[model samples]
Target: MMRRLCWLVMILAWSTWGAAAVEREAQRPAALSVYQDLGGTLNVEQVAALPEAVFRELPERRFFHEYSHSAFWLRLQMSAEQREAHRHWLSVGDPRLSDIQVYVPDGNGWQRMQAGAAHPPESWPVVARQPLFRLQATEQVVLIRVVGDSLLVVEPLLRSDGELLAQRRAIAVADGLTLGIVLLVVPLSLVIGFIMRSSLLAAHAAAVLSYILLVCVVNGYLVHWPMLVPWTSYIRAFASLVGFVCFLGYLRVLLQVARLPSLWARLYDGVLAAYLASALWVVFVDHVQGRFLTEWVMRLAAYGLLPLTLLTAWRRGLPLVWMAWAVPLLYLLQFLARYVFQADHLPWQARQESYSISSTLPGVALLTCTLMTELYRSRARQRWAQQERSQRRLEARGRLEAAVARRTEQLRTSLDARGALLARLGQELRGPLLDIIGSARRLVAMSSSDYPQRIERNARSQLELIEDLAALSHRDELPGPSLRAGSLHAFWREMVEEAELLAARQNNRFQWRLGGNVPCEVMADFGHLRRILLNLLGNAAKFTREGSITLGLDCLERDGQRVRLRFSVEDTGIGIHPDDRVRLGQPFVRGRNVEWIDGFGLGLDIVRQLLEGMNSVLHLADDDRPGSRFSFEVCLMLAGVQDVASVEAGA
Candidate 1:
């Protein structure tokens, strides 16, 4: 394979080298005779009888032969009008062939024919600028009159390849190559695009159409088939313009710029319209070929659109960035070469060999490969994220199962302990109660003064302790799942009322200040929320014995979306120290101040756990609050909620 590739490389290199060599060799000037009859004294028959063999051996065989100079050659001293008419007749064949060197006898010397002149009137009938033509054995020259008798001979102006046939061939070849490449590239682009699942169908359609236009232009111009020139040129130019616009459109779609159209996009559209108008102008306007310069300008403008669109796409972080750059760059090089080289005359093999040997083909392949690689890399990254998500989900499920199992075990143990405690309490209480009641009854029956009163008081005190234990054991079983669509204002109002009651019970003044009516409604378990509020309020009421407490509510908005609801309850009593803050929300944790408080240290821990379960959060409001502000923000469910929309509209 390597060897075969190397051979192909060598063949391409040789072909390119050969084309250059041929061009260099072919462009050299060919030497020939020039003839002109400013004075038309020469006869038509004499001019026509002139040997055409001189034309073929340009710069080689110089002096042309006539049938043995003296034999029947015209010696008529014609007038200038006759000379002009005769020479004009000769000149009618081909302008490029009119100039030729012929031998004209002037005494013993021969002078060459000048361009547009066969000979000088009254002198020699023929002129030879150089004596390269072989003389016949019987040929002889005789002198005529001094100045007027001598025919003028001038050197033939060697015409450069007038038709530029080689150049035309080169151009034709180049054009054919371009068209062939387009044929290959366009179909291949679509095939590869399909394989890659590219959504560039419109752009690809434009490309194929553009390729067809290019093929038409190539056939018309390079092949010298001017009949197809006008229509094909219009189509070619229009198609190319549309192709560029379509490329821009692809970028716009790929980058999702329609979501937020930019200035560049509008301008790109304008430029594309202008390009189409320019193409249309070529069709309607007379002498439109003069506007080929304008077409070039339009092409340049189209070329610039690529980078501008690419820059815009880059700003938007489009996945097609590299493709955007590569696709245009590939075509740009070819476009530049096409115009700059003026390759109208290049041959097909030379042109194909040029582009094929260029880095363009491989560059295109590399570009496609690069895009594929990027897509693959993008997919790989996505796959990795999915795998990570799956792994995380599995880990989260395991932790959740463990937590459920642990909670179940804890509940079972707690239930068993409660049962045993209840059984023991019943046994102890029954004996004591029976004895006390019996004694009290006997005393009441005997009317014993002090014994009856003491027995009744002891029994009453025992009943009070048992009632307190029972009350502690059943503090309103923690809230169940009863979601309520309640207004934030209503919830805050209820929280304030509950906090005030708790504060009054604890001999504390809960300073409840409502900031404003937060119109947002939340969809959440009202019971769980009430428990969260109660824990904070109860903890505050317990800890802050004298000082006031403040609870605040705020709604937050971001990116035109309502996302959060913050609830904070602050205390002015001894603030939680920094060291204990981290430990505050742990189960069974008690700060020094907390240890001195009346109740268990499980309120904040329950609050934290409950909030976590509800996907709400609990945190210290800040590092520098005057006192502890236990705050948490729940993400509001915006679905089926209308307040957020109203608020946003008002804002």
Candidate 2:
């Protein structure tokens, strides 16, 4: 019986303790339920529970209590001045709930006031169809009413309208996207701009990007919690000031003003720096008041800089003169609307400020790019035109110089030829007359047949030399190149025969080699070709005294067309020096080694002219042994049927 009684007692004790703990937990105070702009529904019982000090501090809090049927709501009369002030306040920034409070007048005294705070399940009573509410004596509202020290404090009430909430979220998203695009475009644009060496465009793009980034940051923080709050407002104001100063600095560097007045430049830079330093202080320090109002001062200074840049560019017309006006003009309209019309709307929405500035900047940049391209093209055209004019002038001078040189050479050649001709004529007349006189004397003294023979041989040799001179004179005065068909192989054989005859006079062997499978017909000035070949053969024979001279001919086919016929004259003689090679082709310039030999230097000069007239080339072939081999190549045109017939008849 004792053991069973002990178990029963323990169970009762445990049950009693559990019940006491549950009752204690139930007696604890409920958590604070804070509300902003409660619409005429706050309970007076809950307000009466609040402490007097909490009631006095209510005005500092931001919560509004609405009274639906109060005389203050229905019969509130505002003067024109008061209404204008209210409207101006609304235009400046978003309106905030100042405070929410409850108060009960002390019975019959009104000097002593009792404040109330709203609590859970407490509703303010309605009397005479009006919601009776009392204003607190302070700015802070008592959101929580604790029975004792054990009550829990709740989070502050978040005050926001539906439109503001949505706009804040949108601004955040837009700022993120803008930052992303800037990150991508900024680095790439900077690299490309640096590579291209376009400092103005680079600096402009960077400054614009930085400005955009600043706007995004400011707008994002602003649309959320920090915009209207006094501390954050001051910080943002200062940040904007810094951005403005940075923009002006970038503009100054990009414009590259070297000759601005020293006093003005230093003053402008100093002011910008001062504003920027003030902005930095605001960012770091708290409780820097008047942030929203001070924004105006910075904006005024910022806008003033634009006009200064414009006046400077206008006066100087320095680098990118159009940019000074273009950028400022686009910004000017929007700036005026902000200060004059007080358009402090957000940047993303299509309100007055946003829409105007949004379209203006891109348009200005594109226009500047277009103008720059046009200027570059215009400068290029001008340079090209000038170069063309200069080239034409140089060509005219060159032609005049060539004509003068040709006339002077011709006059010199005429004088030399005349002198030689006169000397030859004197010799010819003296010899012939002496011979005829001797023949007559012989005849008078019973002369023999030998004297007559001697006279005939001398007369024949003199006649042959005169005929050669006459042919040379005629060749020198030949007509322009007239194309005609002729036998290529037959012409070669004639030159070879003439060369062999000349070689026989010098007791030197002569050899000829000819190669071509075609009909060996060509259209050319035959007289010029004949003279060129004769000169080549004569030079070969005149130089080679003991060894053999060889003449070679071949017709070449290029690209399925008869292009050229080549002639080579090789002689076993003292080879020409490398330095004298070009000199041999000049008129009146005999090779040094050939000065002891016979003949004037006119042969090769005349040969070069004839070859040039036929559009041919003469080259000294590189035999490089103990002898010289000079070769000639001429382009040949196809012969017509009538030309072939004439060529065959001439052959």
How many collisions between residues are there in candidate 1?
Answer: 40
Candidates in order, TM-scores: namely: 0.34, 0.44
Worst 10 residues of 1 by lDDT: 142-151
Model 1: per-residue Cα lDDT over 1-651, one tens digit each: 336545554655455555455445431112333233334455433554566442233353122321111211211122333333222111111111112333445454554433211223223222211111222223232111111111122122111242234433554454445344445545665665676566554344444445354434322232233233224445555555665566556545544556446676677577667666665665466324424534554555556655566676677665664555776675576565666775644433233223122323353344345445546766887899999999999999999999999999999889768756755685577677768877897788789576686566447545543543444345422333454455666667766766777778657777765545345465566556767777787677777767777777776542233456677888866778777867777756788755666666767776876787677778875667565788888765543456545544665
After superposition, candidate 2 runs with Cα above 4 Å error: 1-173, 184-192, 212-246, 253-256, 259-263, 276-297, 315-323, 345-475, 478-541, 548-601, 604-651
Question: Deviation in angstroms for 257 in model 2?
Answer: 4.0
Q: Please give the lDDT score at residue 366 for candidate 1.
A: 45
Using alpha carbons, what is the TM-score of model 1? 0.34
Question: Which regions of candidate 1 deviate over 4 angstroms?
Answer: 1-14, 19-188, 200-209, 212-216, 220-238, 250-260, 287-375, 378-382, 385-389, 392-651
- Candidate 2 residue-wise lDDT, 1-651, digit = tens: 335534543543454444334323221111123322124343544444544433322232222232111111000112343333221110111111111132324453222221112111133221111112322322122222111010111112211233223434443344344344445445655665676565555665566665664454333233233223334334445546655655666567544544566765775676677665555554454213223223444555557765775677667766564555656675676576655665555342223223122322453244335335544655787899999999999999999999999999998798678757855775666676566656655665575555554454345544544444555454553345777787776666666766777778778898988876544667777666666776877788788788888888776654344566678888887778778986777867888788889777888887776677777778887655777887888777766567789767886
Q: Candidate 2 — worst ten consecutive residues by lDDT sum?
A: 67-76
